[model samples]
Each structure stands twice: as structure tokens, then as C-alpha cells.
Target: MKSVYPILILALVLLSACNPKSTKQEIALGDTIQTASGLKYIYLKKGDGRKIETGCKVGAYLSLKVKDQVVWNTNKLPDSLFTYLADYSRLIKGFTEVSMLLREGDEVVAILPDSLAYGAKGAGDIIPPHSTLIYDQFKVLKVDAPKKFLSDLLYADVKERSLNAAVATFQKITEGEESENYYTDSEQLNRVWEQLSRDSLYAKAADYAVKFGELAKDDRLKYRNVLSLESMGEYLKAKDHLEILLADDPENKMMQDKMIDLCKKHRMNNK
Candidate 1:
């Protein structure tokens, strides 16, 4: 996927360079050696060889600048690489390359050309076309691998989990009816998916909630699951969850009023 940051912010690249290990073949580019893919990567430093897996708890402290101008950067972003959902596909090519090379407590400054940086589109208007972007990435810390179910729960993998969860949810929503006959609120469904992306647990829980919503016949369980999906910024999902709960309990004026206020505050449709 392209950078998720707004156009003005400098999205990171995947790992495209590594330590000075000799390969069977080598090529050259301007001031850098080349690979068959036309990737001219420079290894600024070596990592400690600590492997980072998807869905692991990792944090990055870094400075980013485009040319001489500063774009957007986080002093330290506590990223939950823990879930398999947090994979290279969702990251930039250069970032993925570098991440593989890094271990716990590693750091490097990677210089990226527009081709490997943000490509022709660049990062919105902040990064110019064919411009170079620089990132000083540091693996400030990492949590121990998941020792329990929660870690496994947050682990991201390119599997059929999402599809299965969605199907299961649809089945429950339709009872004995076929999936083709279901009345799905697509906009609401998308909002739920987007909410999942904000953080790890919520993402996993949302998936579970969708699956549960599909399979569940009890109103009580759905209501409780919505509470489980709550997070710092998952107001949209919360409201949507509440709406589902409201469908089963129209007389619960307190929840109805709370949903109304949350919708108004979030500027989302109450429906």
C-alpha cells in the first residue's frame, strides 16, 4: 500500500538495503551499487540481528526530513507490529526492506530517492516529485513475544481470517437466509473496518465482533462486544456497535441518547 500518512507527511519506505554482504552479482547506480531490480541501496549500519515479526510490540523513534525541509514525524510512535495485519504490504517498500534488517535496539538513517521514496506521486504536496526523502529510524524498543492468547489474538497474518469473520457475521445476521439475501450496511461495515486499523486490539476485536455479530443470536453478547471494541479513537465503531445493540433494544433510551451524542460529537450518521 502507499503511505498512509496524509500527502504532506513523509511516509516511510520498506527495507531495500542491507549489510555489505557480497552477492553472486552486483550492479551500480549513481553513487551506489545496483541490484537487478534497479534498487540502489546503501547500508548505513548493521542491526543487532533481532528479528521483528508482524504483530510484535515495537516502537520507533525517528526524525524525517525532505531535502532540508522538515515534514511530519513522530518522536516516538508505539507501533504494534504484533498483528500479522501489520505487514510489509501495508508499509512502503523501503520501510519493509529496512525493517527486516533491523533488530531490537537498532537505528539507521536511510536516504530514499523518489522512485523508492514516494514515487512520482510523492507524499502529497510535501514531498516533491523525484525528490529524496530521509528517515532516521530507530528501533527504540520491543516487547517480548506474545506468551499468551492476547498476543496471538493481535498477531497479523495474511490469512482468510477477515473473510471468514465477515462470512460468519453475515450468516448470523441473516439467520437461515442465504448470504445473497442479507441486508448489510456497507457504509457501516467500512467504518468498522477503518476503526479496526487504528490500533491492534480493536482491530482484532472488531474482527471478532463482526464474526460474533454474524453467529450470535443473543443481544446481550453484542452489547458487551461493543464495549470490548472501545478504544481511544474508535468512536465510529463504538457508535456503530451501539446502533446494532439499539436494534435489539429500542426502549433503552439511555444507550440511544448516548449514541446520538457520540454521533453528533463524531460527526457521523446516527443511522
Candidate 2:
């Protein structure tokens, strides 16, 4: 029995040697690559060599399209890796697999075949089954781990760029308003203000508002600043600021409600 075991093992080794090691195969337009009931990738590069990994962080901008219609697009905006792989188990098997294989600054387009994409079930109301999807991805950046990835403009360098953009956007919107752009309810103006305020860009917010004589002139923008201060845990200052605004604009219902809420929250947190 022992001698027979050696022969059996030898035979199995010979059988395994019959198949070659799996490798990547490149394809061009009008080409089809077959897979073994799973996802496959085709990597393109500007230079020679290839990058392959089991798991890595990729900073990229992606535009997803189904057939001829545009579905989702980040359009050159910087997006981090964690945004896609927050829950590994929940993501489609193909997306998880392909993403894991990507490296930093590596851009490639993927053709996710139906079986590896939505499959028979399909993505409800959007992606359909037996459908081919084209993903134009450009890997603008990469990181070692998900935690190390930067998505929001919270980084010192990124924050600087965002501040500049915010300032520019604010000036452009306020250019047309003589009294106050805030009263105009301009979406562009509101968006720039909201982002600047939400990110605690208080000084930048104040500078832009004060430059055009817009901050002191508009009650709404002043209220936004008050809310910004409150969010930063400057409770007493925020409340005082709100009170001053209320004294001037007593009929402002929004300001009144906000003041009430901020003071209540401040009291509860202190208690």
C-alpha cells in the first residue's frame, strides 16, 4: 500500500503539470475573451510592464455607462478607495475581485460581463441582466490601506485648493447681487457656501462674505455662519451671534428656529 501511494502521488503531479499557470491576456477593440464563470480583466498602459495585486488602494475618477446612456460619473473628481469597498461582502464579486487587483495610479477600462456584473438578478431599476457595461476609469492616485486614503478635501493641501475654489465660486455668484446673493436663493451660491461652512472653513467664509459687503448685509448668510460656528462647538459664541442677528431681524422665522435649536443642543450637551 505504501509503494502504491508513491506511484499515485507521482501520477497526480504529472497530471497537474499538464496545465500552464494562469496569466493575463490583452485584448483590443472587437475582441472577446472567455472566462471560467467569473470576471476577467484587460489592462492597458501607456508604457511597458504590468501591475497586479490582491488588494490595494486606488484613487480614481470613474464614469459608468450602460449601453449608450450615461449612468454614473465622477468626471475627474478625486474619489478614494474606501467609498467603493466599505463592505467587501456586500459588493458584487466581480467588482471586489477587479478592485483588489488594481494598484495606485493604474488606469484601465473594464468590461464587466453580465455574469460577473448584475447576473440574472441584475441591479434593480438601473443595471440590467445579460448587459455589458463600460467603465472608463483613470487611477489618479493610490494608497497602501483604506484608512490612509483621502476622499474629502480635509487634507492640508486639498483644503487649500478647496478654499481657493470656494472663494472663486463665491465671488462669481455674488458678482451679480448688489444687496445680497443669499436672498436670491441661487443654487450655485448656496452650494459654495454650504460646502465652505460644513467643512469649518469659517475664516474663508467670513473673508469672502466681508469682501463684497455681503455678510453684514445679508441675514441669511449670517445665519449660515452662526450655524457653522455652532457645529464647531463654539456654542456660546454661536448663540450670542444668533441673538445679535435676531435683534436686528426679529421677523426672520428661520433664524428664530435655528437659534432655538442651537441653544437647546448646547444645553443638552453641557448637561
Candidate 3:
């Protein structure tokens, strides 16, 4: 009976060795790279494109989770993805650090310690205080140079509450004739002009409205430009644009009313 038991044990050991549980399917925790700031990550797909730079506008699809529970996912949003200026101040420390290490088209799984994530205070109701975060899949879809979008430049200034900086960034973005010419054909420039008009920086917004209006071929955009200028107290410029529109469409009641209202306001202010 003792000899038979040994033989059975030996046969079982041989069978286990042949199968070996297939280690190829498993990911060893040690394989992940940990940064000095304690951000741990593993790349699922390495990108060959240009590296992301600070102030660049990045459009990405991202998913955040704690354990198996999802916290927020860009994929679930109406846009299915989000675009943001790659400023570290606006993102979790771990995410910013890992983003710097990746390029367009790269996909990664990252684990952020509490210190690099929401930290002691955490976020409102969603992430608990001092809890770690897991970015299950972050895929960079597009990387636009800082100069590609005027909104990217304007956002940095707006975030810092520096109107002067905003003006400077706008000037930097539209420095040369070549750059200005590029914007003439860009639909994104129109979107940015509209966004600026909605921003609280009235002076800057009005400036963009007038400049973009001159470049715009669409009558609707030109009308918005006049309205934006008027809102910023640039009555003379607004009136000039209104007159031009009224010439093209002599009986446009909306334009006529705007012109009449501007004249009334001018007389009232002078009186």
C-alpha cells in the first residue's frame, strides 16, 4: 500500500509539471513601473507618435474606477471623449505624470496612490478621502500643439485669472500673418471666437469678436461679432459692422432694431 501511494504522488507531480498553469496569461505586479511620486503604470500599447507637451490640447478616452466600480468615464459622456489642456494643475498628479510619459495613441493602465490623486480632502461624494484610484484604460486619441487652438492658450490664462496673460497668449497665437491666415479657414477658430465671447473677459472677448468677424464669411458669425462688440461697449465698431450688414440686407428688421438701439444708447450716454 505504501509503494502504491508513492507512485500515485509521482504521477500527480508529472501531470502538474506538464500543464504549469500557463504563466503567459498572467501579469506580474513587479512588471509595472513606479515613478518617484508613487504613480504605478503599465503600458498596454506603446505609441510611436510625438510626445505630449505641457499646454498641448489632448483629446482622449478615459475611464476611472475604484476596484470594480466605475467612478467616471469619458466614453459614457455625450461626446464619448473629452478635450482638455494638458496643464498639471487641472489634473491629478499621477495622471499628469503618466501623460508626460505617453504619446498620441498610447493606452495605459495606471494606479494612483491617494497622495497623487484626490488626497486627504478627496473629491465631492465620488472618491473617498485618502482612497487610491485606478485608471483602467486611458487612450490618447489626439494631441494638438499649443498653437493649434487659441482656446488652449486662452484657457491657461483664464484659469490663472490673468487678463494680461490672456491677451498676451492671444497675441502669441496670432503673431504672424501666416498664423492669422491659417485661422481664416479653420472652423475651430470660429468655435473659439464664440467661446471667448461667452467668457467673462469682456475686453478680450470683444477684441476676438471684431477680428474674427472680419475674417468670417458667414453673415451669422458677423452678426454675433457686432453683438459681442456692443456688449463690450465698443459702440463705434459695432455700429460700423451693423451698417455693413444693413447695406447687404436693407430690410433685416433685427439689424435695423440693433442699429436703432445703438443710436438711442449713444444719444442717452452723451446726454
Candidate 4:
């Protein structure tokens, strides 16, 4: 019986160590900080460079876990880095708070209560509704100056409720840059214009598409311009731009289909 006592004690200790609840308790013991917004974080390694700034581009490696089980890891990402234009409104609240506090070489573990995370709706299949998220690791690798393009500034400005600033920034882009790569690619420009349209800045969005067509001398921008004009209910202007685009790429089946649709809409509007 004396020998069995020691063996039983050892078995109990082993079971406690293997229990998943222990892992959460261990993490909770780390130095913690709470924000007014209810976000809680623990600094595993605080960085020692300039702190992150609004509108800065951030590159980070993150691992998301729930209940001590990893749900996602940046290791699967190309180059193992997730680069984004940091806008607090567009990201999880807890993540935005931690990210704004970090600099290059910083690492942190953040616990996001449901309110600061996906909340009641949760994320898609991987995260359950009302689940608290554990960002087990976030390693900040780079914090870069804001991109030169005004379109890149729009979301942050809008989040800050500085719609006038966003308009001013877009105006600067319209002024044109000396660099030939001022407009990086057609796809990126199109996305920015789409965001503007969503924000109800349809006239500015259409103007950007038209101005980019002139600046880049790329007919594709005219196609985008037509779409923007259509969104604004300027069917006559849209049809005119569409005709210009069709003249440039008569064999483009997508443009041909758009032309057919626009003509039908235009005829209906005239009646």
C-alpha cells in the first residue's frame, strides 16, 4: 500500500500536465495588460524600434489558435508574411490594438474576447460563434512608410472620419507623379476605384478611372471608367466611354457583352 501511494501521486501529476486546460492557465500567468476597449495582451518580446504609425504598411507573421489548438498559421502564406495596409476598422479590434503598439522584431500573444474579435457571427467554418480567439504569436517583421499612392490612404482616412482628407489625397494622385510606375497595375487601381464607389464617391471614382486612362494611355482604364459612370447612373457618359473602349478592343468578348448590356440599358433609360 505504501508503494502504491507514490505511484498514484505520479499518475495524478502526469494527468494534470497533459490536460489542455493547463495550457490556458500557463498562458494566463504571463505578464498581462488590458486596454480600455477590453483587449488583453501579453508581451513575449517587446520590440525596440520606432513604434508603428497610422497608415504604415505592416508585415507580420501570425498564428491564430483557439482552445490551445492552432487554427491558422502564416507559415502557409507565400513568403510567410502577411503584408497589409493597416487600418484599424478593417482588422479585428484586438489585433489592431496590438499591431499599433508593435515595431519591427516585436512578438506578442493576444487574447481577444468575443467583442474584439469575430463576435457573435464568428469567422467562417474554422472559428465558432462567440469564441474567444487566442493569437498565440505575432511577429512584426517590418513597418514601412505609407505607400505614395493616395488610394492607399483612403481607407485609413475614412476610418478616421476624415473624408475631406481622403478627397485631398485622391486629388494629389490625379495631379500625376513623375514616376512611370505611378500607377502600379490595372488591377490595383481598379480596386481602389471600387472602394471609392462603395463609399459613395462615385464622381471621384469615375474621374480617377478616366484620368488614369489619359495618364497611363491604357485603354483598360476607359473600361473601368464606363463601369464607374454606370454606377453613378450617368448612362450617356458610360455609353460614350464604353464605345471608346469597344473601338480599342473590338474582339474583347467581355467588352462586347458589356456594350450589349449598356445599349439595352441606355435605350430603356431614354424611354
Candidate 5:
């Protein structure tokens, strides 16, 4: 099925970036190659691996920048973008045109003009209308076998359907350079946890809270995690986590309040 892969979004609901390697292809490192599709790029490194083809599952890293502002960067994501070559649904608009021409381990600085990218409508508030996006840092990390892509896609589709549309497509767009969606940005993930908690999606909130804590330890997030676990009736987990927090911050009134609340709930449940 065809999918619309628009260009970039602020703080990175968009997609993935890797460190550039400085190996030149037939073209010099700084030489520009403009594809007929109007993609102008400079080769920073050339891949020595298999050339990417239509059926290949490509894993790549790229940072989308409109002028000096960052629309998205894959490096901020601990994972690379996993998609098929020429699959419009799985990639940025016009990026497939370039990906199909690349090979595993290739790195390029691609300038996707406004016309080829988001066009006049642009993306959300992050990308201005008619703005050109620059991938001054774009790298092809790996090319994998095609078989697993379908399974991964199926899993994601299932997860998206399990929740209401608004909750499932939770608005992750952030102002400025804060990260989005990925575990790499604890700041944005904490905000996401806040939203999920507000909606009382405690299970999902707990999941993200774990990842948020992993990225950066925040006491507030730790406390909120306990609340999520408590709401989900994982009382032991909640109490254990709270105990850890209290050991570190014994004077906190909020934790004390929760201890009282948990005790009441526990007694009521036992009775």
C-alpha cells in the first residue's frame, strides 16, 4: 500500500542520523551531484557494501534541517529508520528517490528543495511553508533482509489500533531542539508520559516512564512512575520504586502522601 512520507517535523516525530564517515566515491568529497529528481547532494562517504535496491530493507540515519533549524535528527534516536527501499509510506517524501540510489554505509549531505519535500503545505508548525530541508548529515547505516520488515510493520499497526486515534497518535511535536517520540530524548518522553498519565493510560505511561528514566534519571518522572504503577495496581512495584525515591529524597511530601494513599488502597483491597 502507498503511504505519504512527508519531510521533517520539529524535535523529531519525523525519523533517524549517524556520524559521517569521510570516504569519497568517484566524486570528490565536496562535489555536488544533482539527481533529475532535483535532489542536490554532496558525498561525504561512499559505501563499499551492496547497492540499495527496490526490495531491500534499508536502515538509515539522517538529520532534516530547514535553514539552521533542526526538523529532525536520527542520531537523537537510538535506533535507525527501518523501511523498504522505494516504499513511500516508510520514508520521508522524496527520500526514497535518494535511498534507492545509495548503498549500505554511504553517507551524503542531501539538500531536498521545497518543491521535492513538503511543498507549499509544509509539515506541521515545525516546518514553515515552502521551506527547503537540508540533510547536512545523512548516512545509510545498514541494509537488511526484506523478510522481517513485514513483521515489524504488522506489530506497529497492531499497537496503533489498540488505542484511540488521538491517544495512539499522541502529539509529540516539541518546541526548539527537545527530542520527540524516541527514547533518546528523556525530556520529550517525560512530556509524553505526562500526557499519557493525564489520559489515565497508566500502562503506556509506565512503559514510557521506564524508558524516560533510562535515558535520564528524573526524580519527578520516578515519582510519576510510581503513580502509574500504583494506578495499574502494581502496588509492590510502585512501593518498591517509591522506597528507592524516598531513600534518596526522604523529605519529599509528595512521596509521603502517596505512601499514605497506597496504604489505604492496599488495606481496602485486602479486605
Candidate 6:
């Protein structure tokens, strides 16, 4: 009997070693559904609003945890929600899977296996290797069309960079891409540039102004870039841009007056 017992115990140990299904016990607590992609989630509440789809611009509030430690909490930020285009390739596998199943006002708590979250390498300084991420809360707050989303993001929100990325996506849908161009053609590029400058987002305005100048090789866009730089108090850089403009057209009175004003500011800044 003792010999048989030893054989049985050894068999159980080997079976457990060969099979990793037992690891699910760690995340099986509470009422949770293990999705097809291995995302384990508990639906805290069901939403009655708009459904999420491929191009839906989404907003959500999240509290991410690793074991007992919190890695991210939206409640601590000035705005309680983070906005993103619901293009899953740009997001972690766990967030993508859960997001696809959500609608506006839906909330869920999810546990992402090590393979789905950060994989073996983990995120720098934020996640550890072979970590299981726990989303204590993920609440879908809003969903809107791309244009409406861009409008709200630009004039109302601080996520100007997201606006840029979303705009680039309109031109091409490459996986894991973020771009600052924010326009598909020269005409739209000018509109976005003018809008940013109107809103006093001069740094991004200057960035696009330079991009427009490079693409069209237009002196007017170059002058727009100079104006944006001047607005940002980059007097020295603005003066350099003015000098380039002057080199091209030394006989223009308007550009000459602009250069003189800029040089005085540059000299004062140097002093």
C-alpha cells in the first residue's frame, strides 16, 4: 500500500507540473468569465449607451493594480478618464479584449495573465516581468465619432498629442502608430495649423507649420512657423527663421519690419 501511495503522489506532481490550468485558481475568485483570449473579467455593471466598434473614440477611467500595489489610477489625475481611439493594436491585449466587450457606462474588473498584459519583458519602470495585471476598475465613460472626438479633444481637453495621432490614423491605419502630422493633405493641414494657433497651442502650431513648410516649400507656411515661434518666446530661433525668409526676399518691407522687431527682442533676450 505504501509503494502504491508513493507512485500515486508522484503521478499527481507530474500532472500538475505538465499542466498549467491550476494557475487559473489564482484568478478564478468571484463571478468572472474567462474570455476566448484568456482575459478574465467581472462585469461590475452593464451600460445602456452606444456600443463600441472599430473606429469609436473612447474614454475610460481605470485603476490598474499588480498584486497589492496600484500601478495606475485615473482618480488621481486632473481628469478622471483617459481618452483613446479604440484601435486595439495600439493597446495592451488585456485592455483591448475588455474594451471590445464594453459600451458607454459599462464597467468591469479584469485580470490579465502575464502573457496578455506586458508579456515576459514587462513595461519599463512601470511593470515587472511575468506580472499579472489586475484592473480594479475600468469604466467606459464616452464613445463618439472621430470628428466629434477630435473637436472635443482639441478645444476642451489636454490630450493634444492624442489628437495628432488620431489625425494621422485617418490617413493610414498602421498598427502601433502615433504621428503628429494630423492631416491627410495640404488643405486640411493648414486648417489644423490655424486652429491650433487660434487656441494658442503655439508649440504644436509651430510643429505643424514647419511640417507644412517642408511639404509645400511655401514661404508663407515658413512665415507662419516664425510667427508661432515668436508667440512661444523663442526669440532667437524666430530671428533665425526671419533671416532665412529675408535671404529669399530682401526687398519686402513687411518681412524687413518683422526682422527688425525680432532682432530687438533677440538682443534683449541675450542681455
Best by TM-score: 4
Q: What's the true lDDT of residue 56 in model 6?
A: 74
Q: lDDT scores for all predictions?
A: 0.51, 0.56, 0.73, 0.74, 0.66, 0.74
Q: Which lDDT tens digits does candidate 1 get at residues 1-271?
A: 3655654253222222233443334322223434443344444444454466553434555566787777756643345222221232256665555555456665566666666667888777787777776774434355334222221221232023554645545545456544333223332343344345444455465555555455544444355456555543567777888986788788998787878767775775333
Clash counts for the predictions, in order: 27, 0, 0, 0, 5, 0
- Model 6, 101-135: lDDT tens digits are 88998888989998888898999988989999999
Better of 2 and 6 by TM-score: 6
* Model 3 alpha-carbon drift over 4 Å, by segment: 1-30, 148-271
**Clash pairs of candidate 5?**
16-62, 16-74, 17-62, 17-74, 17-75
Two-way lDDT contest, 2 vs 5, winner:
5
C-alpha RMSD values across all candidates: 17.4, 14.5, 13.5, 13.1, 18.1, 14.5
Q: How far is 117's C-alpha from truth in model 4 (Å)?
A: 3.2
Error of 4 at 168 (Å): 13
Instruction: For candidate 1, report its TM-score.
Output: 0.41
lDDT of 2 at 52: 30
lDDT of 2 by residue, 1-271 (tens): 7899999999988877785553335556334334565555555532222333322333456667789677777754454333343222246666665666566555566667776678777778888877777665534344434322111222232247654554454444447543241322332234445556667776655443333226326556666667666766777778888888889889989888887888888898799
TM-scores of all predicted structures: 0.41, 0.36, 0.48, 0.60, 0.44, 0.47
Rank the models by TM-score, top first. Answer: 4, 3, 6, 5, 1, 2
Q: Identify the superior model by lDDT, candidate 5 or candidate 6.
A: 6
Return the clash pairs for model 2, or none.
none
Output the lDDT of residue 227, model 3.
77
Off-target runs (Cα >4 Å) in candidate 4 are 1-29, 88-90, 145-149, 152-195, 217-224, 234-271
Query: Among all windows of ten consecutive residues in candidate 4, which has the lowest summed lDDT?
Result: 178-187
lDDT of 3 by residue, 1-271 (tens): 7789999999988887788683336554336888889999987887777678875768888899986688899966656877766753257778888888878988888899999998999899999899899988889888876444555555456445665566566565567564643332344445555566656555665555555455545567677777777787777778888898999999999999999998877777678
Off by over 4 Å in 1: 1-49, 76-89, 137-140, 146-271
